[model samples]
Target: MRKDLFNLGPVFGYFFRKNDPNRPTNFNLRTMHFINKLSLAMFLVGFLVLLYRWFIR
Candidate 1:
């Protein structure tokens, strides 16, 4: 079967490949990781905005 970037093979290879282990299934860990990263970025942006407003006054 043809696999995309998010496929089990690529995803696992990208993340858990360093510590290989037998598992029941390959979950969508990559997606969750991406969401976590995005949330952090958004939080940082908001913090910077707040700081700028506090200082510019």
Candidate 2:
């Protein structure tokens, strides 16, 4: 958490740079996209594992 914030500092800086206000800048957009995909994958994997366990029981 704290480490993530530290890592995201430069990312947020670039995200807030001038010339882009309405949408996230390129770096921020890419970072967010990657994070979203990763989280979704993790959620699906966990859900599948839970479903398998429930069916077995």
TM-score of each: 0.52, 0.53
Each prediction's whole-model lDDT (CA): 0.66, 0.72
lDDT of 1: 0.66
Best by lDDT: 2
| 1-57: candidate 1 lDDT, tens digit per residue | 555745657643554455346543345775676686678678879999999999987
Q: Local error of candidate 1 at 40, Å?
A: 0.3
Candidate 1 Cα misplacement greater than 4 A, ranges: 1-27
Candidate 2 residue lDDT tens string, 15-50 = 355554666568887788678767867887999999
